[model samples]
Target: MEDDVRDDALDLLAEVLVWRLAGDRWRAVERALDGLAAAGGDTDAFREVLHDLELAGPARAVRIEDVAVLPVPEPVRERINQLVHTLEGPGRAEDDPE
Candidate 1:
Protein backbone atom coordinates (compact mmCIF):
# COMPACT_ATOMS: atom_id res chain seq x y z
CA MET A 1 0.00 0.00 0.00
CA GLU A 2 1.07 3.59 -0.62
CA ASP A 3 2.29 5.72 2.27
CA ASP A 4 -0.70 8.05 2.16
CA VAL A 5 -3.17 5.20 2.09
CA ARG A 6 -1.38 3.47 4.93
CA ASP A 7 -1.51 6.61 7.01
CA ASP A 8 -5.22 7.03 6.32
CA ALA A 9 -5.84 3.40 7.20
CA LEU A 10 -3.90 3.78 10.40
CA ASP A 11 -5.83 6.90 11.25
CA LEU A 12 -9.13 5.16 10.69
CA LEU A 13 -7.96 2.23 12.76
CA ALA A 14 -6.96 4.49 15.59
CA GLU A 15 -10.33 6.18 15.52
CA VAL A 16 -12.09 2.83 15.63
CA LEU A 17 -9.84 1.75 18.49
CA VAL A 18 -10.46 4.89 20.44
CA TRP A 19 -14.18 4.39 19.99
CA ARG A 20 -13.95 0.80 21.10
CA LEU A 21 -11.80 1.65 24.07
CA ALA A 22 -14.03 4.54 24.93
CA GLY A 23 -17.19 2.47 24.53
CA ASP A 24 -19.92 3.25 22.03
CA ARG A 25 -18.96 6.56 20.58
CA TRP A 26 -21.30 5.79 17.71
CA ARG A 27 -21.04 9.09 15.85
CA ALA A 28 -17.28 8.99 15.83
CA VAL A 29 -17.37 5.33 14.91
CA GLU A 30 -19.66 6.03 12.00
CA ARG A 31 -17.53 8.89 10.78
CA ALA A 32 -14.31 6.94 11.03
CA LEU A 33 -15.79 3.91 9.30
CA ASP A 34 -17.07 6.15 6.55
CA GLY A 35 -13.64 7.65 6.12
CA LEU A 36 -12.16 4.19 5.99
CA ALA A 37 -14.59 3.11 3.29
CA ALA A 38 -13.73 6.15 1.21
CA ALA A 39 -9.97 5.73 1.46
CA GLY A 40 -9.68 1.94 1.92
CA GLY A 41 -9.40 1.25 -1.85
CA ASP A 42 -7.95 -2.18 -2.76
CA THR A 43 -5.63 -2.34 0.22
CA ASP A 44 -6.20 -4.90 2.97
CA ALA A 45 -4.24 -2.81 5.43
CA PHE A 46 -7.34 -1.49 7.16
CA ARG A 47 -8.91 -4.93 7.30
CA GLU A 48 -5.77 -6.36 8.83
CA VAL A 49 -5.69 -3.67 11.44
CA LEU A 50 -9.37 -4.19 12.21
CA HIS A 51 -8.86 -7.93 12.54
CA ASP A 52 -6.08 -7.38 15.00
CA LEU A 53 -8.25 -4.99 16.93
CA GLU A 54 -10.97 -7.60 17.25
CA LEU A 55 -8.56 -10.25 18.46
CA ALA A 56 -7.06 -7.96 21.08
CA GLY A 57 -9.88 -8.45 23.59
CA PRO A 58 -11.20 -5.76 25.90
CA ALA A 59 -9.03 -2.72 26.43
CA ARG A 60 -7.01 -2.85 29.63
CA ALA A 61 -5.81 0.68 29.82
CA VAL A 62 -5.59 3.57 27.40
CA ARG A 63 -2.74 5.64 28.67
CA ILE A 64 -2.18 9.27 27.87
CA GLU A 65 1.28 8.48 26.54
CA ASP A 66 -0.15 5.96 24.10
CA VAL A 67 -2.74 8.37 22.74
CA ALA A 68 -0.19 11.17 22.51
CA VAL A 69 1.85 9.26 19.92
CA LEU A 70 -0.98 9.07 17.42
CA PRO A 71 -1.49 11.72 14.70
CA VAL A 72 -5.15 12.03 15.64
CA PRO A 73 -6.82 14.97 13.98
CA GLU A 74 -8.04 18.14 15.73
CA PRO A 75 -11.77 17.66 15.31
CA VAL A 76 -11.60 14.22 16.84
CA ARG A 77 -10.00 15.69 19.91
CA GLU A 78 -13.29 17.42 20.61
CA ARG A 79 -14.65 14.09 21.83
CA ILE A 80 -11.59 12.99 23.79
CA ASN A 81 -13.09 13.95 27.11
CA GLN A 82 -15.99 11.57 26.61
CA LEU A 83 -13.60 8.86 25.46
CA VAL A 84 -11.43 9.33 28.48
CA HIS A 85 -14.46 9.21 30.68
CA THR A 86 -15.44 5.86 29.29
CA LEU A 87 -11.95 4.57 29.82
CA GLU A 88 -11.77 5.70 33.42
CA GLY A 89 -15.43 5.86 34.41
CA PRO A 90 -17.82 3.15 35.60
CA GLY A 91 -18.52 1.95 32.06
CA ARG A 92 -15.18 0.14 31.90
CA ALA A 93 -15.19 -3.61 31.42
CA GLU A 94 -13.64 -4.28 34.78
CA ASP A 95 -16.76 -2.95 36.44
CA ASP A 96 -18.92 -5.58 34.81
CA PRO A 97 -19.28 -9.15 36.05
CA GLU A 98 -19.70 -10.46 32.53
Candidate 2:
Protein backbone atom coordinates (compact mmCIF):
# COMPACT_ATOMS: atom_id res chain seq x y z
CA MET A 1 0.00 0.00 0.00
CA GLU A 2 1.05 3.56 -0.58
CA ASP A 3 2.23 5.79 2.23
CA ASP A 4 -0.90 7.92 2.07
CA VAL A 5 -3.20 4.94 2.22
CA ARG A 6 -1.27 3.39 5.04
CA ASP A 7 -1.39 6.61 7.00
CA ASP A 8 -5.11 6.85 6.48
CA ALA A 9 -5.60 3.28 7.65
CA LEU A 10 -3.52 3.95 10.73
CA ASP A 11 -5.47 7.08 11.55
CA LEU A 12 -8.75 5.25 11.23
CA LEU A 13 -7.56 2.33 13.29
CA ALA A 14 -6.35 4.63 16.04
CA GLU A 15 -9.66 6.44 16.14
CA VAL A 16 -11.55 3.18 16.34
CA LEU A 17 -9.20 1.54 18.79
CA VAL A 18 -9.24 4.33 21.35
CA TRP A 19 -12.91 5.12 21.16
CA ARG A 20 -14.53 5.44 24.62
CA LEU A 21 -11.43 3.95 26.15
CA ALA A 22 -9.47 5.58 28.91
CA GLY A 23 -8.19 4.09 32.11
CA ASP A 24 -10.10 6.36 34.45
CA ARG A 25 -13.40 5.89 32.67
CA TRP A 26 -13.04 2.13 32.43
CA ARG A 27 -12.09 1.84 36.05
CA ALA A 28 -15.49 3.31 36.89
CA VAL A 29 -17.19 0.81 34.61
CA GLU A 30 -15.44 -2.02 36.37
CA ARG A 31 -16.50 -0.60 39.67
CA ALA A 32 -20.09 -0.52 38.45
CA LEU A 33 -19.79 -4.21 37.76
CA ASP A 34 -18.76 -4.88 41.34
CA GLY A 35 -21.93 -6.72 42.13
CA LEU A 36 -22.13 -8.60 38.84
CA ALA A 37 -20.84 -11.85 40.19
CA ALA A 38 -22.87 -11.64 43.38
CA ALA A 39 -25.95 -11.05 41.29
CA GLY A 40 -25.31 -14.21 39.31
CA GLY A 41 -24.58 -12.59 35.99
CA ASP A 42 -23.01 -15.18 33.75
CA THR A 43 -20.68 -12.62 32.19
CA ASP A 44 -19.20 -11.97 35.62
CA ALA A 45 -17.18 -15.10 35.14
CA PHE A 46 -15.24 -13.40 32.35
CA ARG A 47 -15.84 -9.73 32.90
CA GLU A 48 -12.32 -8.83 31.97
CA VAL A 49 -12.68 -10.53 28.61
CA LEU A 50 -15.62 -8.28 27.78
CA HIS A 51 -13.42 -5.24 27.56
CA ASP A 52 -12.93 -3.88 24.03
CA LEU A 53 -9.95 -1.74 24.89
CA GLU A 54 -7.06 -1.67 27.31
CA LEU A 55 -5.42 1.16 29.16
CA ALA A 56 -2.05 2.05 27.71
CA GLY A 57 0.67 4.61 27.82
CA PRO A 58 1.58 7.06 25.09
CA ALA A 59 0.41 6.14 21.61
CA ARG A 60 2.78 5.30 18.79
CA ALA A 61 1.86 5.68 15.14
CA VAL A 62 2.02 2.42 13.21
CA ARG A 63 1.21 2.17 9.55
CA ILE A 64 -0.55 -0.80 8.00
CA GLU A 65 2.27 -1.21 5.49
CA ASP A 66 4.72 -1.46 8.35
CA VAL A 67 2.57 -4.23 9.71
CA ALA A 68 1.91 -5.95 6.39
CA VAL A 69 5.50 -5.61 5.11
CA LEU A 70 4.97 -7.21 1.69
CA PRO A 71 7.18 -10.26 2.20
CA VAL A 72 4.71 -11.82 4.60
CA PRO A 73 3.57 -15.37 3.94
CA GLU A 74 0.17 -16.23 2.46
CA PRO A 75 -0.95 -17.55 5.84
CA VAL A 76 -0.05 -14.30 7.53
CA ARG A 77 -1.86 -12.36 4.81
CA GLU A 78 -4.97 -14.50 5.29
CA ARG A 79 -4.67 -14.10 9.03
CA ILE A 80 -4.49 -10.36 8.59
CA ASN A 81 -7.67 -10.33 6.58
CA GLN A 82 -9.39 -12.54 9.14
CA LEU A 83 -8.19 -10.36 11.96
CA VAL A 84 -9.46 -7.18 10.31
CA HIS A 85 -12.93 -8.66 9.92
CA THR A 86 -12.82 -9.91 13.47
CA LEU A 87 -12.06 -6.40 14.72
CA GLU A 88 -15.11 -5.28 12.82
CA GLY A 89 -17.26 -7.29 15.23
CA PRO A 90 -15.43 -5.96 18.30
CA GLY A 91 -13.79 -9.34 18.41
CA ARG A 92 -10.88 -11.03 20.10
CA ALA A 93 -7.23 -10.10 19.58
CA GLU A 94 -3.82 -11.32 20.64
CA ASP A 95 -0.42 -9.89 19.96
CA ASP A 96 0.07 -11.26 16.43
CA PRO A 97 -2.13 -14.20 17.34
CA GLU A 98 -2.21 -16.94 14.68
Which has the greatest TM-score?
A: 1
| lDDT (C-alpha) at residue 43 in model 1 | 60
lDDT of 1 by residue, 1-98 (tens): 45564454455444544443333334444454444334334567555544544443335666664443333344454433333332244455244331
Per-residue alpha-carbon lDDT of candidate 2 for residues 1-98, written as tens digits (9 for 90 to 100): 23443344334334433333334443433442333223322443323322322222123554444343223234333433543443433333343354
Instruction: Give the runs in model 1 whose Cα sits over 4 Å from its true position.
Output: 19-25, 40-98
Residue 90 lDDT (model 1): 47
Any runs in candidate 2 off by more than 4 Å, and if so which? Answer: 20-95
Report the lDDT of model 2 for residue 95: 36
All candidates: TM-score: 0.25, 0.23
Model 1: lDDT of residue 49: 40
lDDT of each: 0.43, 0.35
